[model samples]
Target: GTYRAFVDQLPRLDALGVTAIELLPVHQTDPQEGSYWGYMPLCFGAVHAQYAAGDDPAAELAALVAAAHELDIEVWLDVVVNHTTEVDAAGPTYHLRGLDDAMYRRRGDGSYIETTGCGNDVDADHPAAQDLVVWSLDRLADLGVDGFRFDLAAVLSRSPSMMSRLEAWARTRDVRTIAEAWDAAGGYQVGRTWPGTGWMQWNDRFRNDVRSFLRADDGSAALMEQRVQGSPDLFDAPGDSINYLSCHDGFTLYDVFAYDAKHNGANGHGNRDGADDNRSWNCGWEGDDGAPDTVLALRRRQLRNAWCLLAMSHGVPMVAAGDEHGRTQGGNNNAYNQDNATSWIDYARRDEFADLEHFVTGLLALRARHAVLTQPEWWGDALTFLDRRGVDGSTAGPSIGWSVGDLCVLANAWWHPTEFALPPGSWTMAVDTNQADLLDPPTPVDASAYVVGPRSAVILTR
Candidate 1:
């Protein structure tokens, strides 16, 4: 099937340490606009024929799964049950509208509900709608998928019973379920609710908070504190959020710090299609330039801050592809239509952005090395800290602390650099996010305090 070609890329992804593959909406979609992001769906039962492996689509899916299972990589299908691509009376009439238009969608005097603003929002409150969603999921479960990423998941919660039933059904199979838990009307909450029993969410709070911190905006530190801790304020559990600085919808991470205003002239929209309230600071220039060293240093630091937060945060961190190499859309935050070189990964510029890539690799490695960073648990007294002045090797508390066996993380987000006293014994520096020379020899500092660079992170192990 056509999907075999897509599955063939798994080995390369696996080589890069990608443990999971989040497939973008495999469901049938509009053949007209083509629904590039896969948010617009046409059918829940059928896989998009365009993405199928070959003539026999089901066989291709099975082969893809077998290959992925052999490599120990989990597949997460992107499912869009919120709305169908068949919108308006003039659009293509698909399964939902064809079966029972009145029951499948919410209507106000024969007009469809405009909640998703994609012409029509599915009336998930109806039993038929819920059945279709559950049936689609069951089909995927039988296909041996490891998980699902629900598109526009808040719409499901509009009918609590439907959400609850879906959750119960999902628990029967061993699979991860994630929800895009944000709504345009701000009706959705990130924590456990109707559909969030074992479901995680795309943490918009993490994105906004981290963006603010990278831009050095006012009150950013307070917002960042929540994001760093996995946004406990939003989620009931620690792992119920996906921390990301950039994704397919927003500006690329590099563009976030490089362009204050979006240049979307290439998209034929005259910059009207993208967001204007981007909390971005371009260091000095609005776009790319042969800038001076000082400007370059500032831009690098900003990138480092965002990357470090994503790596250190207590959630399933998702790095947008090419973010490691500082890929930019030439300041076009929304490049859904410009499927040219602007959106594709440029292998030639890998060396140009090598430093950023190395920084990200190092940060992720550091995170993987520390169980305290990833062990989905809420902060408590066990996660204690010791200040530089109080590092007497005592169990006494300082200001910050996290425990995972013999490893501990201590951060001083203060403006000035401070000394962190290590316990008496040999302690290795697993990672120093601030220092360029990550493999530099470990210096034997006073047991009373080791100097931590200003606004830096240090991973210490005894």
Candidate 2:
């Protein structure tokens, strides 16, 4: 039934120019536990019967993929190999827990490892666990998914060789693997690790840097330079970093500017379950409603700013569902346990923010038309830090510039207008975030000086 619900959205999703659908885990969950986000897998081989469209869960999932493929959409599964539904002594003996205690790493005193921060983490270092992971992945591909996004992916690298071998096998089957590359425990290997592992990682550095930059924080220009260039410092390989500013974990793109902090009072954990350190900003008022008209408009402008940066950056980009248009979690940052409207994609909001939706589709089209943007190679050259003529250059100001060949993307995160010092050539405005389309795009600047609007970004082509 749930598979039918997902399939029903394909016509809309495909129209929105979405390339892939990365589903949260649909694997079998512990019958006793109340995990709403489906990360607690009890059996890796079985599909969650709850989402079954018919009597058969696997067939239902395959049908879902088959329908997506009909629209040329790739399907990605968020696979959890880190741990199981079984927590500790209080947990029941599911499939893996019942089979062998060796699969679960234990302390000298016999407490199960909690690296995933999910209570009971599996030990992939052991041979049996490694084999199980490989088999689970193979099983998922057989069920018709195009790729796997490994949850807390660095945990699988507890045995680097084992994870590598698994990736090699996946590549052979033409399946893509994206890793979270960091775990709740000590594994924080972002760009330094996972090279040559046949995997891409969710670039949190990219996310945070972009968030800080758009929030008009200090020293964001230097950070944006590294991020827009595909995070070369962390990922040396092409398409190895998933550059995203919003994901399922935190605030929606709309809320990134609409709420200064997470308003998770609805989560019922005393608003204490989610991260306190969300690098976000409220345009003026918390949440969307009742803000001054100018403040509300600024929220939309900031979203466009974020989207413009996301579209132009090198590497695969991911957006949380419902972000194309404004979607707020009513300020709930951590909605893992939210199974209701709080977490569901609101199509109604999609209609309300139609202009933002149009901007996103147009941005993706602009990216597709330009090859340099997709293939952003890092090389040492004369990169310019731009500001208006006659204005003193301030390193901490919310202004940044990146150029490749004749094309330059000038962004002003500053709340006021700033002039960009263009190269000595006539230029065409490839994209102006304030504009609706790029074809008969904004007028070409005939001078070496162009003023970027407050809280907006512009792409100029010579």
Candidate 3:
């Protein structure tokens, strides 16, 4: 899709109540390489010509940013500064490889060190490479880009000075920076180990634990509680964690409930490309095609429960595009090569899954109504984690309850219903994932206890 076409969709995103939109790599890539994901950067300073409808790609990108800002949405661009399309010695020579071989990391024999799984790794430790990255970011900031999400940021973190230099540059422009915090290789740095200070890290721990709890895995309730408390076990502040259920790389939220295993045969990799452990439950039947109505209803309830958990969590929530409307890729998790219907956001699903879309919108609105969900600091003494009986302790069962200020959230991951004892004041129900519609009319609850549905969540406010 062209930048103008993307501009037309900003209003729909605004209606979803998102404060920011992060686009995949917009940097120029080699047209001959046939890369659909744009992870292989050909030039850091140029915009991909295919994404622009007008003659000037830079101008069109600026226009896109302007349109998003008009809708009160901040635009964040994903940047790939780790590797390029120039693979190895036999690969095509781009500007950097042709000009200076020192741009890449090399061994004693002068062969490339492939830490990125892309055949070669950029030597971000080099001063010239650091200068090039800052220069490119400055050019992007000049065009009104609000922030950047670094792909494979662990590669850059390998250098002692690269992150510090980038931070110094970002401070002058007042732009935000986010880190993926891991590389294709085993360079894992998720929390304070990541070099960038004051930068948000994608909390994959939150994603995995939430998915495990949704599928009713053993010992997931304690992990889910840690994630719901903004992952105090991982990060220093709530804003340091960017919580998400799915992203461009993983299964869509709908597919998480519809498919047990990846159907990536279309990627031409023999269905062996995507991650093997997806932590997904098929809800008694795989693939939604001839599933019974009872299974379908359960799937919808599962989706709502996932969204409710994400929205109620005390970190910055991120929703993948097309996830709000039940978009499916035929169970293709690694769709990096298929640019056809498999990757495209089918707008028709908006009408097909209108109820889900409405539910997502309502959940976001409910999140906005509560500041405790997105606040920067920790919950500290104000929040109390409890069991279903309202006793304070580590939640070890399938049922968990928590009270923070005026709000109480109860979640039951069992196959049968569970009753949760309430705290002091009279409570009214604001959300229940079992119901198709949100609480259009708030329902008051009993003074002492409330029964939560099986494999669902409920929220009460006094």
Task: Assess every candidate by TM-score.
Answer: 0.86, 0.94, 0.97
- Summarize candidate 1's per-residue lDDT along 127-215 as a digit string, tens digits: 87788888988887788888888777787777888878877887888788888876655667666552557788888778887777555
Predicted structure 2, TM vs. truth:
0.94
The total number of steric clashes, by the backbone 3 Å criterion, in model 2 comes to 1
The Cα local distance difference test for each model comes to: 0.70, 0.81, 0.88
Instruction: Please tell me which predicted candidate would have the highest TM-score against the true structure.
Output: 3
Weakest 10 consecutive residues, lDDT, candidate 3? 387-396
The numbered model that scores best in lDDT is: 3
* Shift of residue 320 alpha carbon in model 2, Å: 0.8
Residue-level lDDT for 125 in candidate 2: 86
Model 2 alpha-carbon drift over 4 Å, by segment: 376-396, 435-439
Positional deviation of 126 in candidate 2, in angstroms?
A: 2.1
Instruction: Give the lDDT of residue 387 in candidate 1.
Output: 45
Model 1 residue runs over 4 Å out of place are: 1-12, 192-195, 385-427, 434-437, 440-457
